[model samples]
Target: MKAKTHAEEAAAFIKDDARTHWHDETLWHVRSNRDRSAQGIPEWETLRDTASATKNYVLSHLGELLEQFEANAKANGVEVLWARDDKEHNEHVYRILQENKVSNIVKSKSILTEECGLNHYLEKKGYDVVDTDLGERIIQFAKQTPSHIVLPAIHLKKQDIGEIFHDHIGTKKGASDPNYLTEAARQHLRKKFVEANAAITGVNFGIAETGGFVVCTNEGNADMGTHLADVHIACMGIEKLIPRAADLGVFLRLLARSATGQSITNYSSHFHRPAKGKKLYIILVDNGRTAQLGREDFKNSLKCIRCGACMNTCPIYRRSGGHSYNYTVPGPIGSILSPGRDLKQYSTLPFASTLCGSCSDVCPVKINIHEQLYKWRQVITENTNVDKSKQLSMKVAGMTFGKPVLYDLAGKMARTALKITPKSLVYSSLNVWGKHRDLPEVPKESFKEWFKKNRKQ
Candidate 1:
């Protein structure tokens, strides 16, 4: 409850709800939907393969494609800005608001904005930014960062939101019904939407061929907010570009099914050109993403559709929960991606997974998430400072198993020592496995010894 940073919050969630079963089941529910949806399409696997190839092609040629996208977007009347980092990104947005003298803005759910800390930056610059999405609004009022990319306030119950509303909006106490709470949010956001001069949204997909951005939403908040505002801004990662418009068909089919098990989202607004009398802008953000793309093995992560399917399907993610990942994008995807930014700080996340490939199987873009998590561990241990105790233990373990004779002798000695040791020592802090499950019974002899005796018999 006192978690100030994303990592701290994630750790708190895992420790607090150790007994909760639904955390795992909640993800599995989405995974089941994903599996069913993928099965529904006969060419789903082929489609995923194609999407991966296309994305890789685009990333490899990103420099040229970005310039082309910018030129085409400008021709279509959408101003394009390139931000090298978070500070530049924030400054550009702030300057845009100041240039128009617009004070109020409405934004749909945007993980990019969250990543850049855009809301806080704008607030400090003296702009009132209202989150139009219901879940986003809930977390905004609570002064908390979104726990999940797709569902900002997924961790909160209706009762929890009811409390937030009562405190922030003076809604009648004890009104915990979802319908009433949603309507209250709608009315409040409607006033902001009408009064706002600009709206910002996150692009789900950006078609490089035609210079258009796509926003997918179940609530239709993006459409309404953009339509009403005088200016519109679409925030996107440079990696969001697809080679062509038809390529979106492949991603669109996989996005909803992998995300929430729906055939398609309620709305898929394709903004190829700006609306009449409205100014449009696109901010292409490269916050540690370009560096991630440079890595050969980890680059495939760029193809992620931001679908929660991987988290839903991961055994560790389900048990430890999304918040345990300790980043904006939680679950399997976040664990692999978070380490790219701060290798030492978020090192524990990659190790948290059980190396299950369910995440890869469910991924729309085929990111090979489990494999990437493994690769990150080697990178972190080699290039970064690991805990002293862990380093010493690993060194001792390497020495013990470096030679076959030494390994066998050490194994026998270990079994002998285990026989005489008290259960307390076996179950003490020395054993990480014991904390989670019963200690396995040590074998009397090596498997090779047993095999030799069995062959003689």
Candidate 2:
């Protein structure tokens, strides 16, 4: 499939995805797990509080914790590398492969890899990197970016995948059953898993106390890929560290439930040392994360577990689709995180929300997402290169509303203009409102005017 721009692709996916009754049902089915888990726990709220506080504390002392983690990882015979950014990350991985003369590589689900364009980057360098996670593998073969974080190709129906496999991998046509399609991928990936010399996975939780990494997956892909390959590389962002194994218990209890509505993930593999005869490496990537950690209002975003609960519950995310945010990690999490990377390019992301706090309520770590959205708005406004129309309108609105008399005059003028302007102005160019709603009719008299005349009489 040819690549499409983010906006065009997101619009198309949202329109096409709305027709799938199964999509909504699937998410709700998973969300039920969160409800059940919460009901069973008398102190679910307190657990969330602890998790949030723990994460905040870690971020506050990240430098010291990172040094401790590096020392531990090195002591355990794992090679450690710190990447300043995406290019550095890709180059570091590439150098490892080049130095080892490694060609074929197997990878488990790592959104960090996707964010760094790892697969495509390695492919360009003539190394074949195969995604072993079923969801990721499907999207890889389709040459599409993931629409959702957990279920990368969640938008694709079995029939669509069947067609993709038929054309790309020579599966028989018209075999659209999910079980059959999944089995086909499993068999294909299994061969790659056994044959590839090197494997790479993303670290879900990096324990600073032990200097180890956790990789959670439902399908056992990370374990399978890491154990079978001669060499393994696990990538983690600096912000993913937690202080202790005990702290992981609180997060582990809430992560799967909030994410996919499971009481616990099928596999939560913690790797402290490389398995015998396997070469293990861990790459800690910064890539704008340290800058995000320094931003007071947005720093809490680092607590995200990549469960994608925010996107699943977000009305704007469901309606607009992930690519609309134009970041690897989409939805509310992406909105706050993307701005730290390039404020101007991702300024539209924070605006994609409706200021709903569902994302926060569902967050296992309890990030104040709506507050971050509001903070991003302020930062973008102060940057002085806002879209021209928005800049002009903000200037006029600020000037007019700064004075009570000018505000009253402007309101009356707007009322008159609303009455006389052709409906086309309110109907077409401004059609985003009209598409889903009707503008409220102007009152016969202004509320302010009526209240002034009638209040004391």
Candidate 3:
């Protein structure tokens, strides 16, 4: 079966008017809260600058820092492993579980694992894996991948979650209260936490200087799972490292504020060493990150802190929904990153923007998201096989735009057509641009003609 493009998926999402509006408003609310929180801090911009600069330094010295981090982590009794890609990362994780002789696993929110399809891989190997994060668990029950990176189940409503819980976790048929549902989830996950043979967590920051990593979460599920399980496995991309422990202060300040408008995550648990009689493992996975770092135009995208601020502030993303992007991470940032991994599959993603620049404006780490999106579009057009209609149109547009006389004639012809053409013909299937919007009212005369006439007066 042919895969649906981003536009097709987004059209389906927009068909549900109420849900689409609610999704847009809810994300905009988060974006508004982010703005308010950022405004409260006097040095918010400074923090963003510092974080971006720090990440830039890390990218430049990534190999040296990773080595330093591994040495210090081993000194602290933590085992360090490296994986060139997703397959190796999953194998390393499975091998650890196999070596520990465990089958049941409880995991906190880990986008890296999701990117690698770790849960599916482990389940196929006969190991039971449970996602303990509330949003993650919700989506897991729904058998859907995360829509928004930070808010995994942002596409789901309280009513939708209540129904899912009733079906899976045996909640009341119509229970929709936030507190009630939260307590029910806590009770359910408590048993999983207690019985978990191993716990997996995603790393928010890995300090090269100290070899300690931080996992920030409002629910403290990562802390609970890791503390209870005998084996703690942390998965991180190579870009998660910072040069010094102090660098954490800058990122920590920017992350929570940009993500959920909190001053800080409720728990910022740091793991430098394993608890006595327990095992700690860190998997540093490359998975195309090295290639991305080598791309001069897109290396800055690696600096993303996974805050989802870009997603929140993107008007196109707000209207289209994250699932439309069909990538592990979605929205403006994903549009740029996805094409680098698989250009043919994700060629349309880069064009999924208005080039509004709001995404870059809201990014905590100051990644040039909108600019990169534009750059990716240019690259896609030059390298990929674009549609014949689009190609011909662009060629005609190029010729017309390059010649002043042809440009003026085309403008006059368009105005005349708009004045005489029926709405039905103007907004036909062929006119994709006018499908959802009305053309502006045509003026009686072209601006050039009016200017020429008035200048003589």
Please tell me which predicted candidate would have the highest TM-score against the true structure.
3
Cα TM-score per model:
0.91, 0.89, 0.97
The models' CA-based lDDT, in order, is 0.84, 0.85, 0.94
Pitting candidate 1 against candidate 3, the one with the higher TM-score is: 3
In model 2, state the lDDT of residue 443. Answer: 70
The C-alpha stretches of model 3 lying farther than 4 A from their native spots are 444-457
103-130: candidate 1 lDDT, tens digit per residue? 7899999888888999999998788889
Which of 2 and 3 is ahead in TM-score? 3
Candidates 2 and 3 compared by lDDT, better number: 3
Candidate 1: which pairs clash? 10-323
Error of 3 at 84 (Å): 0.7
Q: Least accurate stretch of 10 residues (summed lDDT) in model 1?
A: 1-10
User: What root-mean-square deviation over C-alphas does model 1 reach?
Assistant: 2.8
Better of 1 and 2 by TM-score: 1
